[model samples]
Each structure stands twice: as C-alpha cells, then as structure tokens.
Target chain A: MILAYIGLGNMGYIIAGHIADKLKQDGEPTLLVYNRSNAKVDALIADGKHVQSASIDHIARHADIIFTCMFNDEASKQIIGKDMIGSGQMKHGAIIVEQATIRPDTAEFLASIANEKGLHYLTCPVMGAPPRATAKLLVPLLAGNPAQRKIVRPYLENVIGKVVVEVGDSPGSALRLKLCGNYIIVTMVEMIAEALTLGEASGVGQNKVQELLAGLFAGTPVTDYAQRMTDETYDDVRFSLDGANKDTTYILDLAEKSNADIPMAKVFKNHLDKLTSDYPSLDISGVVGVVREASGLPFNLKKA
Target chain B: MILAYIGLGNMGYIIAGHIADKLKQDGEPTLLVYNRSNAKVDALIADGKHVQSASIDHIARHADIIFTCMFNDEASKQIIGKDMIGSGQMKHGAIIVEQATIRPDTAEFLASIANEKGLHYLTCPVMGAPPRATAKLLVPLLAGNPAQRKIVRPYLENVIGKVVVEVGDSPGSALRLKLCGNYIIVTMVEMIAEALTLGEASGVGQNKVQELLAGLFAGTPVTDYAQRMTDETYDDVRFSLDGANKDTTYILDLAEKSNADIPMAKVFKNHLDKLTSDYPSLDISGVVGVVREASGLPFNLKKA
Candidate 1:
C-alpha cells in the first residue's frame, strides 16, 4: 500500500505535497519521497505529514505505487531503466506513474519496457504552473492501462488538480497531449503579448485590453497572462523563461516529427529563443516584454 | 425623446431589437428605425413591438439619441454627412452612436464632424458574433465624450451586451481597442488550430485535445471553438470566414500604422487568406481545417 514520489522541482514539490497530505488523511502507508536534492526532502519532512525521505533503491523496492516527475526524458529514462525496472528494485505488479513531459516516442518506449517487466506504467502529465498545483487548479492528462488508471485516479483529481483528461491507452498519447496543451499555453502568451502591445501602441492602452480580456477570456490563461502583461510583474519567475523555452523545443520536435503545421508554435519558439536569452530570470510570461521591444517600446508597460 | 436605430445586419438587427424592447418596457418613445432595404424593417414591424421604420431625414431631424450600426465607413459617412449632420436635417446638441467596425480614422473624422456641428459622436464597437448579440453576451467598447458616454451607457450594458469597456475620450480609441480584441480572438483561433492539428498529427486525437481544452479554457472562446474543431462542425457558420477575413484587414491595418510587430497576427492573416480562399462558407474556426490539410490530414477530425 506504500506510495513513492520522486523529483522535487517547483511543480513536483507542490504536487507531491498534496499527494502526501491526501494519503496521510486517508490513513494510508507512509509516502516515500526521493530527490537528488535534499532541501525539498527536508522541507517535506519539516512539514511532518505523511512524507519520509527514501533512497531510490528503497522507494522502488518497497513502494507499491511510484510517481516520477523528473526534468526530462533522459533523466526519467535512466531512473526507470538502470535504477528501477527489472533491477529487483520494484515490487511485482507495482505501478509507475510518470508526470514529466517527455517525447511521445520516449514515453511509449518506457511504457513498453515497464510492461514487459510485469509492471504497470502510466503517463499523467499535468497542465498549469506550480501555483496552479498549489491552488488545485491544474489539469492532469492521464493515459495508460485502464486498470492502472483506476488505481491512481484517487490521487489526482481534487487532490493535486481539479480535473483529469483521460488521454487513453498509449503512454505516448498523454505526453503528446501534454505538448498540445503546452502549445495552447505558450501560443496564448504570444497572443496576449501581441494584443496588449498592440493596445499600447495604438494608444488604446493596455488597461482597455485588460478590460476586454477580463470580459472576453475570463477564467482562462489569457486573462492570467494579460494581467502580467499589463502589470509588468515578470521578475517573480514562477515558471522560468528557460523552462518555457525548453518546452518549445519539445513542441517543435513533436510537430517536426509528425509534420504538423504549427506556425503559431514556431512564432512562439522564435520569441522564446530571443526572450530566454535576454531574460532567463523572468517568468515565462516575459515573452510580453519581447513583444513590447519589437514594437519599439520599453520593456516595462508601467508609466513612470 | 425619440430614439433611432439604423442598419439591420445580423448583429445590428438583434441589437436594435433589444434596444426597441428595452425602450418599450420603459414606456419611452417608439424607436425610429431606418435601413436602405425594408425586409428587415418589415420583419421588425411584423414582430408588433415598439419599432417603426422612418426615413434618414426623419430620424436625423427628430431622434434625440440615434444609434447607427452600418456596414462600412463609406456608407456610414454618406448617411452621417449627407443625411444627418447638418443642412437643416438634424436637431442641435443631438447624440450619434456609431457601432460599426469601421476604420479608426473614419470614426475619428465622424466624431470631429459631429462635434463641430454641435452633435456628439460616440463609437461603441462590440465583440462577439451575432449569436452572442442574440444571447446578450456581446462586449461593447465605448469611447467618446464622457458626458455623451454617460448618456448611452445605460442603453448599452444589460440591453444588448453584458459589459462595456469605456475606452478613453477619442472615438478612434474604441475602434483601436476593438481591433485589439479582434486580434486576441483571431490569433486565439490560430493557436487552437495549431494545437488541435498537432494533436491529430501526433496521433493523440482531437478528443484528448478537446478534453484538455475543456479543463484549461472552460469559460473562454477557446472552449467554444475547440468544441467545433473536435466535432468537425464548420459548415454551420456563426462567424463566416469572409467576415473573419475582413476583420484581419482592420487588425493588420492598425498594427501596420502603430508599428506593432505581431507575428501571430501575421500568421493568422496568412491562414485566413488560405482558409477563406478554400472555405468561405465555413465558420472562422474552420482555420483548423487548413491546419489539418497542411498536416496531410483530412479537413475534418471525425472518424470515417
């Protein structure tokens, strides 16, 4: 009945916290947590909930259900391959849940590997930043075996996120859908940036754009990014520009491999490449600053 | 207090109907309505509400607050200049409300002419399609004299639309903001098209994308358009590709004048050009079909 959580990045950290809290509330087995960095592990321990620090070997061998949210495909692959699967580390019939956004082919390959080892693997990549994870506003995409899906469904919805989008059987499907979601988000930022900048440039003011966005696109990411675009509050770095730029790489790669025509995504990637180089420390919404600069305006929209 | 409404296009017809209803409810003057063609006027008269068709000269001379929603600048100018502003056709200190999506300069010029002749001109461009107008979901952008805005604000909100974004004093300001709002919508279509096409091309399917869009953009136009994309419903055009393509002209014109570098809008324009050439009868959301065709797939997402 033991559950294990891995990766302690911003999104992973907040999500793992929710899972531990829910399990502890239900009086389930202690949640085994593992990360290369111990600070997050120590922070989870200090919270003194259901989470306990565990080494990779310990988590894989003991935990009945393991969740991984690593940085990239290669990192997630190594841990699932050399460290866990068929290495006498994980219990038989144990479930491995992947939340990291990796290439569809890579995810498919890993799912096959785990299946061959008498293990169940599922991809459940989520939509939204860490703040959304904290607020339980994230949308998790679930794809894999129906049985494994049923087992982990309790831990996702109303726990770490508000809803779940069942992406169906292929593990690649969830990851590909995750890329499509990211495609919507990043291109949405570009759309917001352009609209706000156009407003400012045309002397209509971003304030009016803000008003229109509130009325037209309320409860969506467009409103969320429009506020940031109008407010000039990018230094907080909730999701770093570097990470957003990295996502464009995967989105473009998926489009390239599939021969999908996503010119909007290409435009976003061009903006991301420029913005990530210029302001790596700002939040991903900093693409607005690039749009402002291209319009020959100052980086900040706030009037002095 | 005579009230006049000119033009009975799909949007204007529904809006004029609402205004006539509101005035009837309040026991005010019967609305003075005028249009070149009398079919819509016949239709309105047949409804047996508080509306009666009148000549342009009669409306100009008698109506205290006149609302005009014409097709283009030239037509609006001919009516405003030759039929309304002066030459003993209109009363002094009257107010003219223009709700057409005309050029910024044309609105400004109309405002200037109306002001010089002791008449008030206000631009009240609205967002949303004719269906939205029917549902009272339209967002109107108002810009003009503050006192004049005060005169018309009551008739706008809760009558034809839910809210009005008061865009500054310059009449052109509202038009500019309207273009910006259009920019957000059309670019949003491009983003949705690219994301759904990417999903289908990658073999993830638009159903998964539809589920994700529902969760991520629940209350926005993205959800509205995503449903159409996933369902392959394009022939029942709510916002025709021709009309959508015309809007891109104003949007690009504004961006060109303002020197705003909106690559997303440019991409949208390119797609609109292609989509309109191919599917003029389809809805503007039919841009998804172009994305699919470019990806070597069928125009529709529904399975055979």
Candidate 2:
C-alpha cells in the first residue's frame, strides 16, 4: 500500500512531514508528497524522508491512501476535482482523507463526486496550529463510512493525531464540526481582545489583566491568546488575519446556508474585516489592537 | 478589629461562612453576619460559628472592616446606601470591601459617599462561584487606596481568595475589570452554544462535540460549560439566566460609557435578552438551547 500527502502550508507541512516520518520509521516505502509550490516540496525532500510526486494526478493514480490538507475549499476543489477522481486517475477503492477547513456543502459535493467513481472520501479536518501538528498533538474530527474510518484510523492515530473523533458517516458533518470549532476559536480571540481592551481602558495594568485572565480562564484557549494579546506578539503571525478572514467567511456562509443565526460570528467577522483592511498582515490576535483602538487605548497593551 | 460579612446568598453564604469560620478558628472576636433573608443568616448561625447583625446599619456601626457580597447594584446600593455609609453608621476609618458584581459607576458613587464619611471603600469583586468561594479559591480583583489595600490584603488573601489582583487606586477599576472578566465568560457561553448547535445540526453527536471542545478548550470555562450544555443541565442553574443577563447589561453599559465598541458583548447581550425573555428560568448555559433552536436543531442536544 502506498501513502501520499498533499499541500505544504504551515499546518499541512508539519502534519504531512510527521506522517511521512512515522511511515519511514516503520520501514514502509518512502511516502509520496506534492505541493503547489516546489519550495515546500524541496524542503521536505531535503529532510530525506519522502519522494516528491510529479503532480496531483500522479499521486491520485499511484497512492492507495491519500491525505489532502489544503488551505481552503478552492485549493482542495482544484486539486481533487473531476480530473483527479472522475478521470480514472485514482484506482477504485482508494481512500481520500481531507483535512482542510472547508464548507460542508463543498465537502458533500466532493464526496458525491468521489463516491460516483467508487473512491472512498473522508472528511477529517483537524484542530490546532502548525506547532501542535509538529508535536503530533493535533485532533482530527473524522466523518466517513465505518470501513473507510477503520482503514484510516491507524495512520491518523499513530502518524498524526493525538485524538481522532469520529463525528458521523456524512462527509459534511466533519466539515461542519471543523467550521464550528473554528467559529469558537475565532470568537474566543474576539472575547479576549474585548476583555483585555476593557481592562486596559479601565486603568487596570496589563499584568493584572493577564493575571486575572490566567486565574479565571485557566486552561482554555482564552488564556493562551491572553498572553499573546498582552505581549503584542502579532508580528510573529502563526495564523494570519487573511486566513482567519477566510475561515470566518466560510463560517458565516455556512451559517447563512444552514439558517443559523451566529451573531457573535458576524460581529467577529466585521471587527476582523476592519482590522485586516488596515493591517492585512497582522496575526489573528491583532484583533486586540482594533479593540484597544476602539476603546481609545493605545494599540499595544504592553506599550500602554 | 471587628469584621463583618453580609449578603448570604448562594455565593455570599459560603464565602461569609468561610470567613467567619476562619476568624473563629483564629480566636478573633465574633464575626458579624447579615442577609436580606433571615433563612441564610439563620442557616449560618445554626452552623454554630458567627453572630448575626441586627441589620445592615448595625453591621455598619459595629464592624471595623465590613465585607458586602450583595447580588446586584440595587441590592448593594440599598444596603450600603445613604442610610448606611452617608449617615455615619460605619465607624470612622472603618473599611468596606465590596465583593458583589456591580457597575463601576455604582462603585465610584459608593466610594465617594464612604470617603466623605471618613470610611474607606474597596471594590474587590471576585472571580469563581460559590464552591470556589467555599474552598477559598476565589480570585479577587481589588482596587482601592494603597493603605486600605494593605489593610484588607491579608483577609482577602488568607480568609477568602486564592489570588488577589490589585488593579489600581481607583475604586471602580476593580469593578470594571470584574465586568470585563464576566463579559469574556458570557461570550464564551454564547460561542459554545453556537458551536454545539452547529455540530448537532450537522449530525455530529453531542458526545463527539463535547470531546472536541474538551480537547480544544481544555481547562477553560468553555469546557465546563460544554459539559453543562451537552448534559442539558442548564435547569440546574448554578448561574442563572437572570444573573448572566445582569452581567451582560453591565458590560454593555460599561462599553457604552467607555465609548468602546464591544460588538461581541452587544451580540451576547442581544442573544441573552432573547433567550431570557423566553426561558427566564434557564441557567446561563440555557443560551445553548436558544442557539440550538435558532439553528433549527432540538433545544436539547442530548435529546437530539
């Protein structure tokens, strides 16, 4: 059986690299890899664990099990389109594991097309940043047929994820879960920004605000983001505003299509849009600066 | 120095009982206690530790340091009003530590009146619920004169709080910080509710959603509330919709007063308002039901 990994962005690179390393350590054949950019592919190849595939079609035809971690729907759609699945590139019964934050409808469409060609498709979008993926601490939200899930569970558990949650049999379910998770995370950033802004505006010292948040929020994402907000470390962007904007847009679109009223997501999207327009390169945490500025406080809490 | 504890509600009862027990253990003079309802006062008295004050005025006159943990602005205002602080009921140089969640403006007004009467007032609104207060695990956000802060620091540290954060010299700063903390918490509930609704609507089991949240949110308020949301335990009402609604309103008011654009808080306030109007008796976590309903999912995710 051959294994292939696609996409080489921050998160995708770390996760795919980890899978390849694990497969190599187990004395399996060299893993197959591909990316839109040759630089990431070259970087991975230089590390000496995998063979680079000539193209998406090459991996689709050659690999028994392929994992795709594209940045968004468009990237995934372009690479995993009819040409890859419908054109007889993928052998019948080969499994496709998708691990991107995409809309449920998109996942469903992809699943329908892949199923038509007798190719098994699983939506397994993951949670955590590149660092977590590198540490093999990322959690996968998995949704697929029971047999396909059983086939991929070993790699997801041993090679990449700390926890793999089987959401359901529907392909869209995993994507929806991922979008919902992102919605929570993005909303958390907004809440932290607003809270820190309120604290700074009220003449509470940044250290004290951090202390209170550390005490109250304890082990949550809010505490992690609170440190970033207090330190004004947006320049070291792990997740850019542009990426967050894409996720937020996807979430809002999903909510609209589902007729779910996620007003907090809407509010966050607007705040993010305004902030990203002025400082498009800022990290997702830079929303704190927008919050602080709106409250008439200085941009950086540390400086303030 | 004489010490008094007032307002024996769910949180106030346990916190005052703890303070009184600690003081008794130290062999200090009797701790003075008061509550609007005679039952809680009687319950504490029956626990065989402290003496009950005849009235708020009596505690004001007798205690050198008075700790009030009233429920809201109106309740606190009534007890610490002109008849109490303004009428020279509190002895000169006595200290009043306000631990209730109240508006910063109300705190400032109370401080002004107390100061005029040669009394020191400290806004020391705390984080954590009744159990935390009972365990002396509550974290206090304190703001007052430095000398007064020094005087109360020991009691706040040893008798009640696990950690004490001194925000600033302004009396209302602590209250503002507390409100900000609450805003983050309330907004967290909304985000959790929205995410869970999305998960359920997309056919993700509540257990899987809870697992993902537990892995993602970890030791945060989100995890605790996620458990509550999935169990449909909002009816247990440790923190009621009424209480959350009050805090959200205070946050929105503070934001408006500060000219801060807390759009997330505004969205939360609107959501809470709608939810409370329909299910006034629901726990704060009941906001999840509202979110689920909005998404056309069942009100109880567990049932769904």
Candidate 3:
C-alpha cells in the first residue's frame, strides 16, 4: 500500500516528513508526496523520500490512500476536486483523510461527493503546533467509516501523531474538533493578557503572578501562554493572534447559528479583534498589550 | 502599642486573626477587635485575645493604631467618619490603615479627612483571598505618609502579609493597585471560560487542554482557573462571580477616569454579568459553563 500526502505548509510538511520516516521504518507502505509548491515537494524529495506526483491528480492516481493538510476548507476542496476527483485520478474505494481545520458543513459536503465516487472520505484534523508535529507529539482527531479507518490504520498508527481520538463517523467531526480546540487557545490568550495587566496594576508584579499561577496549575497550555503574556514575550509565534482571532470569529458564528448565549467567547472575540489594532505587528500574545494600554500602563517597559 | 481591627469578613477575619496571633506571641502590642456580627470578635475574645468596643469610636479612643478591612469605600468611609473622626474618638497623630478594596478617589478623600483631624492614615489594600490571608501569604499594596508607614512598620512586618509594595504617596494608590489586580482575575475568568467551550467543541477535551496548559506553564493563575473550568469543579467559592464582577466593573470605572481604553475589561465585565444570570449560584469558575452552553454542550460533561 502507498500513502499520498498533499500540501506542505508548516503542519503538512512536518506530518508528511513523519509519514516518510514511518514508512521507511515500518516497511508496510510507501510514502507518496505532492505539494502545490514544487520547491517544497523537491525539498522533501531531496531528503531521499519518494515523490509520487508533482500534481494532485498524480498523487490520487498513484496512491491508495490520500491525506490532505492544508490552510482551510477552500484549499482542500480546490486541490481535491480540480486536481484529484475531477481528473478521475482516484481508484474505486480509495480513501481520503483531511487534516486541515475546516468548517463542519464543508467537510460533510466533500464526504458526500466522495461517497458518490465510491471513495472513503475521513476528516482527521490534528492538534499541536509545528514543533510537536516535528516531534511526532501531535494529537489527531479522526472521524469516518470503520472500514476506511481500518484501511488507513497501518499508515496512521505512528506516523502522524501521539494519540488518535476517534470522534465519530461523521465527516465533519474532526473539523469541528479542530475548530473547537483553536477557540480554547484564543480564550487562554485573552485571559492571560488581562490577568497580567491586573497583576502589574496591583503591584504584585507580573512575573510573580505568572510564577504563582504556573506553580499552582503547571499542566495547562493557558498557563504557558500566561507566562508569555506576563513577560510580554510574543516573538515565537507557534500560533499567530490573527489566526486565533479568525478561529474565534468562526466559533462565534457557530454560536450565533445555534442562538446559544456565549458571552465569554463573544468577549474573547472582541479582545482578539481589538488586539489586531493595539499591537499591529506583534503576535497573538499582543492581546496583553491592549489590556496594558487600557489600564494606563506600558505593555512592556524598557529596562532603565 | 495597641492595635484595633475591624471588619471580620472572609479576608478581614483571617488578617485580624493573624495580627492577634502575632501580638500574643510578641507580647508587645495588644489586639482589639470589632465586627457587625460580633460573633467572630466574641470567639476571639473567648480565645483570650484582647477584644474591645461596640463601635469604631471606642477602638479609636483606646488603641494606638486602628486597622479596618471592610467591604468597599462606602463602608470604610462610614466606619471612619461615624465612629472615629466625627465622634472625635481619634488621638492626635494616631495611625489608621485602611485595608479594603475601594475606589482610588474614595481612598484619597478618606485620607484627606484623616489628615485634617491630625491623624496618620495609610491606604494599604491587600491582594489574596481568604485562604491566602489565612496563610499570611497576602501581598499588601500600601500608599500614604512615609512617616506613618514607618510607625506601623513593626506590626505590619510581623503579621499582616508577606510583602508590602509601596505604590505611591497618594491615598488612592493602594486602592488602584487592588482594582488592577482584580481586573486580572476577572479577565482571566472570561478568557478561560471561552477556551473551555472551544476545546470541548473541538473534541480535544477540556481536561486535556487544561492539562497541557498547566504542564507547559505551571506558574500561571490562568492554568489554575482553567483547570477549574475544565473539571467543572467550583462548588466552594474562593471568590464569587458577583464579587469578581463588581471588582471588574470598578476597574473599568477607573479605566474610564484615566481615559484608558479597557475594551478587554469591558468584555470581561459583560461576560461576568451574563454568567450571573445563567449560573446564578455557581462559582466564578462557572463562567466556563457559559462557554459549554455556547458550544451546544452540557457545562459538566466528562470525557469518554
């Protein structure tokens, strides 16, 4: 069996590299790679991995299983339809697993189309950033038919992530999960920023509050993010604020659709939206900057 | 020296207790106390600690130093004016320290009146809840006459809190600090709540996100609060949502006075306001319940 992987952004690139390493070690399936950017594909190829196709159609035709890791739903649909499905590159009963963060409705629509073509489509978005992906510590949330999951089990067992949580058989379950996860991150950022500002105002010192919180509850991403806010350190953008804000907006839209009262999320979204203006060039952690500005305090003071 | 303490609420009671304990051990200053309910004072009196006065005036007439830890600015002003200043119970140059969380302007006004009476006054509001106060781990943000601070240094150093940060000479400085610190907590509650909902929606599991954030940044309050949110375990209120909302509103008011853009704080206040309606009796951590509601999920569901 051969696995076809498309897209080579930060997440996609790292995931594809892991797959190649897994194939070489496991010897159960070969790795086939294709990226819209030929340089990225060539770069991966130079690492001595198999290059199955320069185009999406070639990847679909040559590999039994296809995995997509892209920016959003639109990109995923474009590559899969224009280059793979529309070109009749996929064989009967071929499986497609998506790892991008996308809207639930889009994933379901794509899945239905795949079903008509006798293709098995699974939504399998991932958790963790680029660093975790490189370290094989990413978490994968998969949703699809039992048989399709079984067919890809060998390839997915260790290649992509540390844990694979099966959300459901619905195609959009994975996407929903991913979107939800992003929502949590933005909320964390917003709170960290506000807390840090408050701590400084109280004369407790931001560093002390950061230390106290981290010590009390040391096993949370929000705490790690809190430290960053307290220190005003936002250089290493594992997740950009703009991305977070966008995800939060999407969640808000979801909440609106359901007519659910999400005052907390709505508040968080407002923070992120304002953050774009406060620290125009800073990372998402810059939300803290807005807090400081509002309290008549400097976000970060220069050491005298 | 004799120290008279007032206001035996959650935080006040612990602080007064600590001072009494210290005075007992040192065998220097005598401890006097008063409260509206008087039960806690009666208990302390029963424990052989010095107790005095049906009103603040009695303490002011008898004690060398008068310390108060009331609910807000109005209460602090009322206790000082009706029982001490207006009653002519204060001794010339006797030091009075206010430890309530009040508006900065109120603190300044109270300080001015104390100054007119030839009494030394210090605005010395503290950080930390009842638990921290009980442990004598609270941080005090103090502002007032340097001479008065020096006079009370021995006792304040011995019992009240762990650290005393000198914010400014202005009467309102300490109150400002307190407001700023609480702004942080309220901001954190809003952010963490939103994140919990998002994480649940994404299938990452709220507990998982909490765990990840805590481990990564274990010293942040964000993690501690986020963990409470993830577990939905906030029965015993360390801090109530109503109280937190009040503080946030106060902070926003201060922000308005400074002409500061505290949009994040406004968002936090709004969330807390809404949370009061949904989880009327739930603790501040129950803000996460609002998030879960937005996600179309139960507020207290365990991961399968």
Worst 10 residues of 2 chain A by lDDT: A200-209
Best by lDDT: 1
Rank by TM-score (best first): 1, 2, 3
User: Which residue pairs in candidate 2 have backbone atoms (N, alpha carbon, C) closer than 3 angstroms, thus clashing?
Assistant: none
DockQ (CA atoms), all models:
0.88, 0.60, 0.22
Residue A101 lDDT (model 3): 79
Off by over 4 Å in 1: none
Q: What's the C-alpha lDDT at position B227 in model 1?
A: 84
- In order, candidate lDDTs are 0.87, 0.81, 0.71
lDDT of 1 by residue, B135-242 (tens): 988998889999989989989989988777888899999999999988888888888888888988999887778788778777777888988877778877888876
**Which docking class does model 1 fall in?**
high
Taking chain A by itself, what TM-score does each prediction score?
0.96, 0.95, 0.91
Steric clash count of candidate 3 = 24
Model 1 Cα lDDT, one tens digit per residue, A1-304:
8999999888888889999999989999878999999999999989886898999999888988899999988898899866999586678999999999888888888889898889988999999887788898888999999998999999998998877888889888999999998888888888888888999998888888888888887877777788877777888777677678768889999999999999988888888888878887888788888888999898886745
Model 2 Cα lDDT, one tens digit per residue, B169-243: 998888888887887788878888877776666566556667888897676567788888888887798998878
Deviation from native of the Cα of residue B16 in model 3, angstroms: 3.7
What stretches of model 2 exceed 4 Å from their correct place? A48-57, A87-89, A205-207, A297-304, B50-58, B87-89, B205-207, B297-304
What's the distance in Å from true for residue B283, model 2?
Answer: 2.1
